[model samples]
Target: METLEGAELCFPQLLNTSCRKPLQHHAETIFLYILLSCISLLTVVLNLLVIISISHFRQLHTSTNLLLLSLAVADFLVGLLLMPLQILLIGGCWFLESFMCGLFYYASFILTSASVGNMVLISVDRYVAICDPLCYPTKVTQKRVQISICLCWVCSVLYNGVILNAFLKHPDRYNTCYGECVVVIGFITGAVDVILTFIGPIAVIILLYMKVFVVAVSQARAMRSHIAAVTLQGSVSVTAKKSERKAARTLGVVVVMFLICFCPYFYPSLVGQDMSTSVAFSIFGVWLLYCNSCLNPVIYAFFYPWFRKSIKLIVTLQILQPDSCYAHIL
Candidate 1:
């Protein structure tokens, strides 16, 4: 096989057809990619189910779930439309004309950017709801939440759109099977992408979550201070406290997942040094980073009993009943 750049891009392709074991591993990796795409799709579907179930129920509909609905929709789009192409990309198949290729890649980047941005918004929204319960409803109205979600998508699209334009200006950018892209410009553009995608959002998440943590602790203390008031209040205040604790636990899991899945892609970008890792490592790094999208349904399964219950309920109702009986249930 021939080479293109310095040693950076060579590392991944080196193991492709040039090596005996590596050539044998290609089939297996493709199979695993199928599995990966399936798992990612499953999570996306599950998240969508949660959104649909919540929306249909109406009792479960809230501003928070609306944000979650947006997130679920974005993630589902990635899993359905993006992940398979990414698997193809990893296997060194360009599979499109230049403009189409640019469009596909940019859409993936923009959707991902929007998802992380939505997460930061969710964290801040939760912090406000918890820290200042009295002001929560007025501050985070339904209209504001909708506007915020739209803005997140717009910002994400605009940011990645610039990078797409920058990278798509190749001279031999022709309709050919040989997939060649200007990845050097991508390096600088991608650094900006990483910051918008990870750093700025993560900093906001951590800062907002810090306030969330402190507010939670403060609320706990205040509850203690108001034991007398609570005693006079009966079971209402206790129920409210329990719900607050539940929301905090859910938020905590989200923050931890963000840190673990996203940190690998962040620091290298921030340092302004090109990746010195092998291409295999770089490829694996990207897949691992996207694995965060696959993790949400699993985390929801483990952390949120309501989500699980809803899933179970929907499955049992939908599959357990026949099409003849479905109308009656509906």
Candidate 2:
């Protein structure tokens, strides 16, 4: 009886303090491991390809792609660092030290906030390109976009630091047993975080996309009406408008998907409950949110011809050739 009980504890030596292992079927555990492993691997590969594509091809280094590169970097870190840790967590044990637990949650919050920031930036970029096309080149310069990306990351780090200050100072504060890792935010902080990180950004993205949609429709109709009267210069203008509209549509899909993935994660806050990582619903929400990182690159491959072309070059190892950065991707 003693040996059997000992085997069930996370730390057999510290039986009184250690958490008991979760009761999971052996086959079920194997299945979950395989399924999650595949998702993690896929997320890593897809985001890595996006990073390589945008970074390697000079033609792909426009201001818009820069936002995508920032997003991919966040998602890549999610797969490389967070997902594996989450996978290990499936057995309901925290093998690492308390300090490492604090760092893990810190990194998670930073990446999540950064992703939200990037999405908001992408929406604004599309709004400028589609609604104010003539002024977009001057208004949204590469230097400006670079500065925006840096601020997004820096702000994410600082913002999450403030929110998680207490948790960071004492990572083991809420742990009920020796092997558990969890964070529990106060209701007020969670409410503020939801509004700042989820609600406010989502509202902005939707409003911007709504205006973009309206403008795109009007532009499409005008282009069709003027199709017969198009001279060489007029045709060029129409082509540019079409390109901008297509980009808006593609990014609109991305924003919609982002909302779908993120909505559940913030539901507890929406309902005026404290955000606690120990809750089953919160665990599910976190994984769903993480899955969004996997989906973003897939969306790019589906909608953007340049991404597909870049993937082909990368897979064929043609990117290894000299001066490959100058290859025409667009």
Candidate 3:
């Protein structure tokens, strides 16, 4: 009944409920609209470039790097497909007519499910490498890693499919506005998603990482044993041990990023989902999730010497070759 421009006008009142001081509705709407659009487009394009650079370069195609590439690709798709339309919605311009809405949201939801699942898998991979060093190679072979990646997609599809169908508009109830309500359907769907996406995966990741971190520490102590056992072999053993530590540290960053990027997406369910409240909370979630696209490259750049070397090598060769600008010189 009452139109309070958009998220801006409503946000302050939301924080200070008693104050009831509304924002300049139109100005806030316009600013939010522009902000979302710029962020969406910019992040989308950057992630695509990152994916291409990784794929096109031979030196950057290790198993771990491949997993990172998949993450960037998935997040890039979320930014490109979902965020731009969400920006339009924030501007009160919902261009996805009734037909396309379900399909678009379905793709976005499924891919996001896959993305979180993959994060869990990546943690497991790193955990195995750090904790069970002897078995890591035999257990996580190239074939095994590929199979795990495929299983991630499979799990995402089945999990989201059941949940989506549970909320699907029944043909029998389609005509009755009084009996068939979308909000009730939305509440059920959101609750299920919150459990599968956040609760389940969060539990698994924490348990696995705890094991991994503890093992990493123990192994670090074990390095001292190498000094007396084989003084000449100490250098090789230490190098291997350092690599193991670095992988664990990278996984720590991955866990923190996943938690920060995705927690907002689940907050609406944790709080009571009054329509207006849910609207702002959901938008914040989407924006935070979109922000994750820019972080992987940055984290890798700062923390991963191997990844930095690969990126630098790729860039250097581009300047060296005219026709084959993408090829590495070495």
Candidate 4:
């Protein structure tokens, strides 16, 4: 009986200071490992494609795709870094040092916050383009959008540093055993995190999209009425504008999916509790959140013809040819 119990401990040699392994069936564990491994791989591949498509294609170097590029970067890191670490945690125990544990959560919060920030920027960009098309060219220039993205990422790093300050200062303060890795925020700090990261950003996203939808419907009606009266050049411009709106609508779906995946993870904080990754439900919530990174490219950007073309070029190694970047994708 003692030997069996020792076998279940994460570090059998450190009996008293090791966490017990989670009681999971062998088949179930194998299934979960395979499933999450696929998610992580898909997330990495899809986001990498988005990154390559936007970075290599000159036509896609617009203010909007810049935001998407930032988002894909974040999602790419999720698959490359966070998802693997999480899979390790979910397996049984955190074999890494406590300091690494704190660093992991710190990086996770920064990426998650950056993703949210990018969504808000995307929403604002769409809102301006749809509701105030004339001013969009002046207001949402590439330089301005690039600056906004830089600030978003900088702010995310700084904000998470503040939120995770305690953990940074004392990495193992929350650990109960050598094999355990955990992060705990106080109720007040967790509430603050929820308000800033979840509530406020979500409010801005929903409101902007709401206004964009109303204005988009009205514009569609106006365009339809004016279609016959417009000249050829004017008609071309209108078509281009319509295409912009279509892209916005696609990204809006991405934002909604992000909210759907994240809300459940933050619900415990809404109910006045710190997020605990040790529990089964919390781990499930975290994985669900990470899965969003995998879906964004497929659901939001992969449908574009230009994206398909870019992928073909990339796969065939044609992108390395002379002036490939100058090749018209759109």
Q: Clash totals for all models, in order?
A: 0, 0, 0, 0
Q: Give the Å error, residue 249, model 4.
A: 0.9
Ranking by lDDT: 2, 4, 1, 3
Candidate 4 C-alpha RMSD relative to the actual structure: 2.4
What is the per-residue lDDT of model 4 for residues 1-330, given as tens digits with 9 covering 90 to 100?
445454688888987778888778999888988999999999999899999999998988999999999999999999999999998987669898888888999999999999999999999999988877667888999999999999999999999999999899888888887787888888988999999999999999999999988877877887888753455533436777788779878988898899999988898899998777675864668988999999898885555788888888998999999999998898
Could you say which candidate leads in lDDT? Answer: 2
Tens-place lDDT per residue, model 1, 1-330, is: 644332233134544322122232667777877787786677568767766666655445678878777877777776777666666555544545556666666676687788788788888788877776657778999999999999888888877667666555652243222453213334676577677678778888888888888877766786778752534323336567657767766867876876787677555666776533233643566566667777766777787676766676677765344442223211
Q: Which residue pairs does candidate 1 place in steric collision? A: none
Over 4 Å off in model 2, which ranges?
1-7, 227-236
What TM-scores do the predictions have?
A: 0.78, 0.95, 0.76, 0.94
lDDT for 309 (candidate 2)? 98
Error of 4 at 114 (Å): 0.4
Compare candidates 2 and 3 on lDDT and give the better one.
2
Question: How far is 135's C-alpha from truth in model 2 (Å)?
Answer: 0.2
Model 4 poorest ten-residue lDDT run: 227-236
Clashes in model 4: which pairs?
none
Better of 1 and 2 by lDDT: 2
* Local accuracy of candidate 3 as per-residue lDDT tens digits, 1-330: 444333333224343221122233788778877877787777776666567667766665656666777787787887888777666545432334333445555676787887888788888888777776667767878677777778888888787667656334442222121111122236666777777787888898988998988888877776766532445423336677788788779868967887898887667676746222223544687678767766766676677665555556555665345644345522
